[model samples]
Target: MRLRHLLSASTVMLGVIVNTTAFAAAPDVVRIGVAQQGTGDPPVFGGSPAATAQLQHRVEDSLKTDGTKVEWIFFKGAGPAVNEALANKQIDFAYQGDLPSVLGRANGLKTHLLLASNVRAGVYLAVPPDSDIKGVKDLRGKRVGIFRGTNLQLVADNVLKEHGLSERDLRVINLDSAASQAALASKGVDAVFLDYNLFKLQRQGLAKIVYASRDGGLQFTRQAHLLVLEDFERAHPEIVQKVVTSVVQASQWSSDEANRDALFALWSKSGVPAQSWQAEYANQQLKDRSSPLIDPFLIARYQAVADDALRLNLIRQPVSVNGWFEPKYLDEALRTLKLQSYWPRFDASGKPIAC
Candidate 1:
């Protein structure tokens, strides 16, 4: 479990037969899938300057001299759509949120958790101004907009349970984030569970904040993680290692205190307000949540997520969280970059566990 041990494993070494560093079986094109809303000018989600492009450049520089390229696959249906691509073997790597990632694995999609990009991201619950809805308790018997097949469905349901309510108690309407936001603003739905977009609408006096997981603590936050297809891992560990290194490097940069303002600005390029980003990350240290380390906290949290999915029938079977992680690449990357001690580590409760 130590960085030194993981990095020194023989499997972590680069493998290439010719002057060309391309794998004997490396695919001509590497496809990285984005499981978020879109990849437009101001994307809803993607790894543009984050890690995907950096991975492409690094691979071409050190391994693929024959113009091996990285292609990004964008999705509108979010995690469910990305799971389709992963199941069909159309993608080599993917970035996804909790529910679909775990469900895919439970249903036999072969992939490994590579890294965690962000955590403690609060889900926004917005009700129309002058509406009688006050909180989760008020959501019962009300029409609430939820994106069913995505993680939001389960996340919102869990939040409701925390208030002694359940999805069964409400009239749930399925809609994507964009449509959901519009519907809420138009009073088409009694309430909506979404992300920072809700807060932005709240600022405009179009919606009222009913409940925010921001006050619910780290255990309530939804997480996004990077994953690699298992077949690709067995065939091209070298490529996987390099790609993970790029993400680790990005995480390192994102966790620096000096980069806090710049990171928020870059994130705001996705069309979210700069002030919203500031509020969401308020009082949070950069490395506390952004650290790429696959620690005990992260592993245990994902385990509980899988368990919850089973209990709620979101997933048919249980997934083994521990075996699903391929941390050698991340460990190796940290050591080579001399960043083993650069980021803070925390336990399940978000308490500082290491540095």
Candidate 2:
């Protein structure tokens, strides 16, 4: 069974591998960009476009003519690459991380935060297994690896702040995820801001997790959004609605308890290994984390993120967080699909806002 394939015990502890929308006169091909999906050779359960891609086919087939095509773009450069694509009006929808999407808006790429793809993603700090850095503060003056301009940077900075430290207090070395992992292996950096993949390094005894935001607070965790270009949305509301409908449908399937094993297996194609998903999702409810609702909680958090980014000089001009959301599409999708109560809504601090 596909579900059984996803839950194979040997796959659990091992290490491996590893949006948008809008409309014009319905372009010949609809380009969907996955900012964090670098080439997506090995599917990652975290935020892969696999589920949505399948859902997209159905939506497109029913909503458009046979000539219409769906084109997916995966960028290894992550958010920045997608941001560039969106800016050039090459991408209609973008499933992207919080920080880059925020910066994109601040830089004048018009997009509506349609539905949230994911929330409460964890950030990890990995240090050499033999290092004396017992906690965040211990590395104040030491070298720290951060993939600058990515959401991980903010998560890392926020974690540091929680420990009464700041990026200013440390020698911040900018490195991409792979390079940072390698740096940690070579002891090139005292610590590297990373994610669930930290487990692989731990298995290798190359690094150890010093801090993580896996506990109950949403603000402490990284967030991702599903966004659509404003121009496209303005041009074809019908297509945008269909896209939102499909996303909601996919979200519904994803939230179902019975599909857990199959869903994880689908994500295992990213070379992350099925077991890695099991470990990462241990004790966590899939629905609680993947709600597609564009609730106030995300809006408030983005406002706070924008405020902090302004203070931190991550963006030139202030990003209008409130304007980022155009919830009508999601609202309609939920209502039409009878899924209004399917996904719980939360406040910006991540508390369930009674539906």
Candidate 3:
């Protein structure tokens, strides 16, 4: 009887040990996908903490001691291709734009919005120098190139509607960023709706900037974010916390006014000239753009993106912003880092507010 009783206790101990081992198992690698690739051989990106984190190796540095490797996969196809990777479970996390992420959610991709990577990023409209087109309204009945399925498409639509025009009023061509630049330079397209890269073309006298979203105010700007797979988050909350914390640290550095020049220099690796970044960010505060908070303003912008996405038939169904954001990790990171008040909070109207 004594021997039998001892054997039973040992069996229970062995079961507990197996369960604990399974529970604590961590993946050997963490795969991160970036929607946009940079110009280098092993590309780098800019304009977000995810980019900063990658350039600085913050995330990898945090996990290196644990024997976990970080793999960053950049997509030349941008946000739409990132959605496909997410769908196939080929990536554990992604840095993507608002529209593509919403479309992914509507199509049943289970992920959590970690935090805003970049916000209030303006778009531009450029036409060939000496062209007859002078403004947004002039694009009516003219061939205009846009990178469809990107955050730019929705912003372009909104800007057109503001000018009493829609995409239907123009001959719209779906071109990627590089193709759009080439087409605009060759006058293959009458005008191109693009980002700061257009400034480079203007410098070369290849294109004329007719309109910029900065003049239209913050509502016309676009947003991007960092998101993690739902399954990955559930399985490794500790690793998720570390990743979020590391990104928050990078954000803190990127937001400082003292680091402005250094920040621009670091981001210029993406093939965009530093002067272009300086011009684009010229009246903007770094903290306002580089904020890692998932505040009310961020939520409102995403919800508006979802609404517009549906109204524009970009998505088959409505996507909910609620429960889509997982803020506890961000909250904990801010708290532990003693940076709860480091970044300013904004209201839904994009005005600064106390929280």
Candidate 4:
């Protein structure tokens, strides 16, 4: 009888130990890597659903009860640099663009796509103030600056292709945003492909805006997403769910059309002017750009990006978009928050589909 009692106690203690071990699996710190830097000294970014989460402290608030610290590490080198940090295990989650993320996956980084953080960001073509280059065709034989290895590169190359030009036809210089802007200011490069940030150069009288992607249509834009290192997600899925939930909450808030002014106000902390954000999103519905759903449109776009990368020799091996996404967390969050139909779904061609 005493032996049986002792065994019962031992079993209870073993169960307690196992439960404690499970609880302890949650890390004390969660590091998230951001692909680009914010404008100011303290460094905050805006313009995406993930950015909205950061701005609103959604993730931090979600994890705080567990005594977990959330750290947002921004990389000025953009997605490529974020990929390096992911390889080093310095970060568990990342907000990165399509190409660099695909490149990382092709190179053997294990991560699962969690959510579509942002999409359909337009591209811009800017030239020196006095240059006569008026269109993409005129870029042939000219010194063009592009941030190579970024999502920008593939689209820029395609834009060139559409105009009967190629990277081979131009003196292509690999430059990041700041360097490209400086090169344009110094007239070191004849033209630079940029995003909405190009407006800053035009406002400063440093560059001329020749082409805006919005003028061409939706196909001209690029996409980005929130992802988690597979190891981390496998180890602490609860924490991953919390993070995804917070981002979805932020996306919901950001997608509300009534919060337009308030949303820009929050984003302007990144040192971009409120007017710039306003102009960037002008005549556009907030819900379309801020949706967190990994719908058919997003999947198709990523697959297309992967194909383009392989065909352009941008990635050595084919990065399959299939099984790359883990959407259960997102789906669960939408269900839990009752936001299943909050954001509209889009088809592969960017057209809205009924729920």
Candidate 5:
């Protein structure tokens, strides 16, 4: 099938009309949902109340002109609960990992991508610090930790394939990030796929990366994005535009060094440790400013995800990139805010120019 047909259809032009109507009947309040990894820290990045406050502040500021009020609804549960809220239309929007986004879309949820956050280049295939394993090919016949149906798992598969190995060649163990990290530290698994933030573990000399995914173009390149239900978008188009605008503004603000203190402060108060907040904050900013601008390249990456998911039997049908994204609202928001100057310059053909 053609790529266009495989992805969601373009609804950019219709988005404006739908959004306008939604704004006209603006509800007294809008409820936004959030998801986060709950196992490790006090205030999770997107799930904790502290992160909620910061988001509320930003969204309120953006929607003030539209006479909209904001309320936050956080889900302490993991992936399944988040999906339930979205399916039930209990919330307006959500910020979640890439794999969940794909799963939600495949399940017929009306979700949209708002922005990318924290494109860490450090996801690795790690073994106990003392392990003799040296590369992806070394994992054959060994137990490997992975969270199935996730970006990490997909990347793990890609990396092994590149090394002439397959999942069938290893004993695959299913575990979440937190669990996988612990299993690696205890030497319970021969090798585990993990994010760079596990540097804390590496500092203790408990683990060492057998293969660095970033350098090999095999890293998950995970993106946390904001998504809203289709009915919500249809009901409150103007509000959705405001939400998108707020996200763009927040992303831009997050890129500034002076803003780092305030960002960390918010994160720290939300239950994240000061040190961890600092690390994640810096990583998110670096990604926001320097990562590949969202365009055809990203669309292709999403397609790759769809293809891989199908091969793994994770999802039943192929998904197209076009129908999944509606960039018109973003463009509209940028133009209305006259914040075009804040965005990187692109040619008439929509190619980004080097600064």
Candidate 6:
């Protein structure tokens, strides 16, 4: 009887050890996908280890304490590739522009918005530096380079409509941002509708900004959003909270004058010239407000985007913006991390004010 009791105790101890080990190893590393642009033009994600390191550090700091790890995957192609990876379950989260996210939602992919970035940042209509084109109206019969199913196209369409022009008014060539920059430099297209950052190359005298979407307070509403696979969020709430916390912290860090300089330095190493960085940095600071918080206005804007996307046939059907976003995750993360009180508050005019 004594021997049997000893044996039973040993078995119970072994079972406890096994259960602890399994519990500790249950959660897998989170995979994040980022778009990688080529070495030329605006330099989205190519060079600079310091910048990448900073980003990695921010992510680790957010998720590491809970035994979660993050693995980043870079895709060399455009938004379509990123969306494909998300669809294939290869990545848990990504930063995508407005149009691609809309397209992704339309294709039966489950996605949710984490936060909004740079909604008011403008798009530029550019031409070769020496070209005589003076305004949007001048490109009526010219070939225009644009990335279909991206924010650039949305801005182009809205701007053209404002000018009493339509898609039929110009020759539209579907091209990615880098390719569009090359096409513009080589004069393959008379003009290109591109993001504000891409204008960095044009500022180098490689091209010229013929028109900016911000000219008329037009509210072009070009935006980038943090997206998470719905299923991933369902399975890993803690990991998702960590990601939201980190992104909020990064945005706050980027807001500081000192850290802004560091970020610019990182961007500069990525092929963005100093002057261009200064200009784009200022513009981004204004648009992003560097708080990484969402507001009612942002939600309304997202709803508007979904409506416009459906009307343009960029999306098959309208997605209810309310169903796709849950600010609770962000709010909880901020509160838990002591970030809520420190974040900048923006007024109705989109200007930052003391909270």
Question: Which parts of model 4 have CA positions greater than 4 angstroms off?
Answer: 1-24
Clashing pairs in 3: none
How far is 16's C-alpha from truth in model 5 (Å)? 21
lDDT of 2 at 342: 79
What TM-score does structure 2 among the candidates reach?
Answer: 0.86
User: How much is the lDDT of residue 333 in candidate 4?
Assistant: 100
> Per-residue lDDT of 1-355 in model 5, one digit per residue for the tens?
5776545344655777787765678777787666645323332353222243344487888777767777666554545467888898787787665666777788888877754443333357889989999998889999999876555777788788889998999999987777888999999999898664455577778888667666674234554556677777876777887777777666666555676666656555554445655543443443333232355545555667777778877789877656777676777766776765564643423345666
Off by over 4 Å in 3: 1-16
Model 1 CA deviation exceeding 4 Å by range: 1-25, 39-66
- List per-prediction Cα lDDT, in the order shown: 0.76, 0.76, 0.91, 0.90, 0.65, 0.70
> What is the per-residue lDDT of model 3 for residues 238-310, given as tens digits with 9 covering 90 to 100?
8888888989999999899999999889988887888888888888899998999999899999999999999
lDDT of 4 by residue, 308-344 (tens): 8898888888778999999999999999999998888
The best candidate by lDDT is 3
Whole-model lDDT for model 2 versus the true structure? 0.76
Scored by Cα lDDT, where does model 5 land? Answer: 0.65
Best by TM-score: 3
The better candidate by lDDT, 1 or 3, is 3
Preferred candidate (TM-score higher): 2 or 3: 3
Query: Higher-TM-score candidate among 3 and 4?
Result: 3
Lowest summed lDDT across 10 adjacent residues in model 1 is found at 46-55
lDDT tens per residue, model 6, 130-152: 89999888989899987876666
- TM-score per candidate, in order? 0.87, 0.86, 0.95, 0.94, 0.76, 0.83
